[model samples]
Target: MLTLPQLRALYPEAPAAHLTAFAAEAARLLPAHGLAANRQRCHFFLAQLGHESGGLQLRTENLAYSAARLMQVWPSRFPTPEAARRLAFSPEALAEAVYGGRMGNDRPGDGYRYRGRGYIQITGRETYRALGRLCGLPLEEEPGLADDPAHAVTIACAYWSWKRLNPLCDAGDYAGLTRRINGGLTGLQDRYGWLERAQRCIPWPEAGSEALPLPRLRAVQRALKARGFYDGSIDGIIGRRSLAAIATLRAELGLPGEGLDAPLLAALAA
Candidate 1:
C-alpha cells in the first residue's frame, strides 16, 4: 500500500495531513474498483489523480479567467476579445456560455451546476448521469458530491473502471490512458513526471516489477545494520531511523551530513 510519507516525499508541496486522509480513503475504496490487484494501475491512478487535482488541493475548476486568457482557453466561445471581456471573471456565466446546450445540459443552469468536479474532474451532465448509473448514485442531480473529498476517490475509481483504464496502465500505455481520461494528451509531461515519482514512492512489495529498483536504499540499510549504527529492520524504507543512521555515519566519516546518495551508500559500505 502507498504510505503517506511516500506521498509527501513525492509531492513535497502537498499538505501532508490531507494526503494522509486521501491515501487512507483511496486504500479503502480503490480495491473494490479493481485498482488494488496491480500496482501499475495504482501508480497511474495516483499520477492522474494527483496531477488533475493539483496534488489533491484543488477540487473546483478555476474558471476565473482574464478576457485575453479566456479567449485563448475557450476560443470557440470567446472568438472575439469583446466576447471574452463580456464573460471575464464571471465563472458561472462563462460555464453556462461554454457548456450550455452541450453534454446533456439542456436547462438554464445545468452547465454551471454540473461543471467539472472530483479529482478527475467529472464534467458534464451526461458524464454525471452515466457515472451515477454505474455507481448507483444520483450524481446528475447532486453533482456537488464530486467536489467533496469523501466521494472524490470513489468517483475517480469508478470513472477509471468505466473506461477500462487498468489494462492500459498494465500495458504502460500512459498516452492512451491520458487520452481516455482527459480526452487528449494534455499535461503529458507532467503526467509522466508524476508517474515516475509514484513509481519511486510505492514500496517494491506493493509495486511489483513496476517499482524502480533503489539498490542504494537496501545496500545502505545492510551496511548500517552490519556496522551497528542502525537498529531498525532492513526494509530499505528511509524512515527517520535510516536517516539518523546515515547522518551519524556521514558525520563520523567527515562527509556532508545532508542527502542520501551514491557517495553516502559507498561510504556506508566502506
Candidate 2:
C-alpha cells in the first residue's frame, strides 16, 4: 500500500493534506481494480499517473496555452499562429474544437463538459460511459467525480485494468504503454523520470504480500542505521530497540506512526 510519506517524497511540492488523501485513496481503490497485484504494476501505474496528473495535483487537463505552444503541441491541429490564435488561451473553446464530434461526443458542448479528468485523464463521452460501465460507477452522468481523488484513482486503475497494462509494465515496455495511454510518445522522458522515481520509492516485494524476508529486513535495518535512523543491533530481528528506532525515524521524517511499512523500507533503502 502507498503511504503519505511516499507520496510526499514523490511530490514534494504538493500539499500534505492532498498527499494524505491521495495515499488513502490509492490504498483503498487500487486493489479493487487489481492494480495492487504486484510491485511492477504498482510502480508503472504510479509513474504514469504521477506524470499524467502532475503528481496527483492536476485533476483537469490544463488547456490554456499560447498560440506558439498550441502549434508546437498540436502541430497537426494548429499549423501556424494564425491558425492557433483563435483557440489560444481559450481552454473551453479549444476543447470544443478539438474533441467535438469525436469519442461519442456529438452534443453542442460535450467537449468542454467531458474534457479530460482523473489521474489518467479519461477523456470523451464514450470513455466515460465505458469506464462507468466497467467500474460500475456513474461517471458518464457525474463526470465531475473524476476530479475527486477517490474516483480519480478508481478511474485510472479501471483504465489501466481495461488496457491490460500489467504485462507491458512487467515487460518494461514503457514506450508501448505510453503509446497506448497517450496515443504517442509525448513527454516520454518525463515519464521515464517518473518511472525511475517510483522504482526508487517502491522498490521490490512479492505482490499482495507485506511480509519482508529476514535478510531483507536486516538489510533495511542496516540501511536505516546507516542513515542514522536506527542505532541498534542489526540481527535480522525487529526487536524493541529497532521498533523504537523506527518510531523515532518516522517522527523525525514527519511520517505517520505506521512503523516499519513498505514505505519505511523504501525510504531506508534510499
Candidate 3:
C-alpha cells in the first residue's frame, strides 16, 4: 500500500557513475508514458549491458558468432564491402551486425543459439516484429538495433510502455509487458525470476532499492495486502512478507504452486 513517494523513500542510497546516469535518463524519459520506476528500466538495461557489451564496449578482436555457435548464415553481413569495412572500424557496430541477425547467436550449424543484441538484447526474427511495431521502425529491414545502443534502448522503452499490449497496466502490472515482451507468460520475466533468484536470491537493481519483500509481484500484492494475504505493504519490493503470503495462497489453491516464482505468474494470469 505504499505510494510512489513512500516506495521511493525505501530506496537505499546508491553510488552513481555507471548506472546512476542511465537511471536518471531512464526515469526522466519514461514517466511521460507513465512507467513507474526509473530504476526498473535502468536496472534492466544495465543488466543487459553487462550481458551484451561485456560491461563497457565490444572487445573488438572478438565476435559473438562463430562457426560452431552459428545460427543463421548471411550472404553479406554488411550492405556492401564498404559497409563491412565501416563496421570493422568500430567495435560497437560490428557487435550490432552480429546481434541484429547478421551474426547469429545460436548457430545450429555450429550449435549456436540465437542471442539477440543491442542494449535491450533484441533476439530472434520474431523480436524484430514486436520491436518494429512499438518503435515505429522496420527492424527486419534495418536490423541494426542489436548493436546500436541508443536505438536498442529507445525501442525497449517503447516496448515497456505497458497496457498498450495489456490495456491494464498500473504500477506493478508487469503482466501485459511480460506476456508480449517475453512473447508469453513464461518467457523473459519468468526465466528472469529464477535466474535473478539464483543470482541474488531476489532481483535487486545494481544501485537501487529491492523488490518488495512480498509475494508474487503482481497487482495482486496491492489487493492481497488489502486482504491480508500480504501483510507486506504494497510497495512492490518482493520481500519476505510477500513471499510468506504467496506460500499460504498457493497451499489454498491446491495447485502445487512453488510458492516462489514457478507458478506465481500463472496463478495471477489464471
Candidate 2 residue-wise lDDT, 140-229, digit = tens: 899988887556666787899888887766544566688889887777668777877887777666644333434666787788788786
Deviating ranges (above 4 Å) for candidate 1: 10-20, 75-83, 206-270
For model 3, the local distance difference test gives 0.44
TM-score, cand. 1: 0.68
Q: Give stretches of model 2 more than 4 Å off.
A: 15-17, 206-270
- Candidate 3 structure quality by residue, lDDT tens digits, 41-90: 43333333333333424311244334322222232444444444444444
TM-score of each: 0.68, 0.72, 0.37
Q: How many residue pairs clash in each candidate?
A: 0, 0, 27
User: Which window of 10 residues has the lowest lDDT sum in candidate 1?
Assistant: 207-216
Model 1 residue pairs with clashes: none
Ranking, lDDT, top scorer first: 2, 1, 3
Candidate scoring better on TM-score of 1 and 3 = 1
* Total colliding residue pairs, candidate 1: 0
Q: Model 1 over residues 1-270: C-alpha lDDT tens digits?
A: 657777787667765555766678766777887787887778889888878888777777868889999966667768999988998998899889888889899999887888888778888899999999887888987898887656677788889988899887765556668888877666766777787777767655642446223354567788899988899986445556876887888888888646465576567653
Q: Which stretches of candidate 3 lie over 4 Å from their true place?
A: 1-28, 33-45, 56-115, 162-209, 212-246, 249-270
lDDT of every predicted structure (CA atoms) = 0.76, 0.78, 0.44
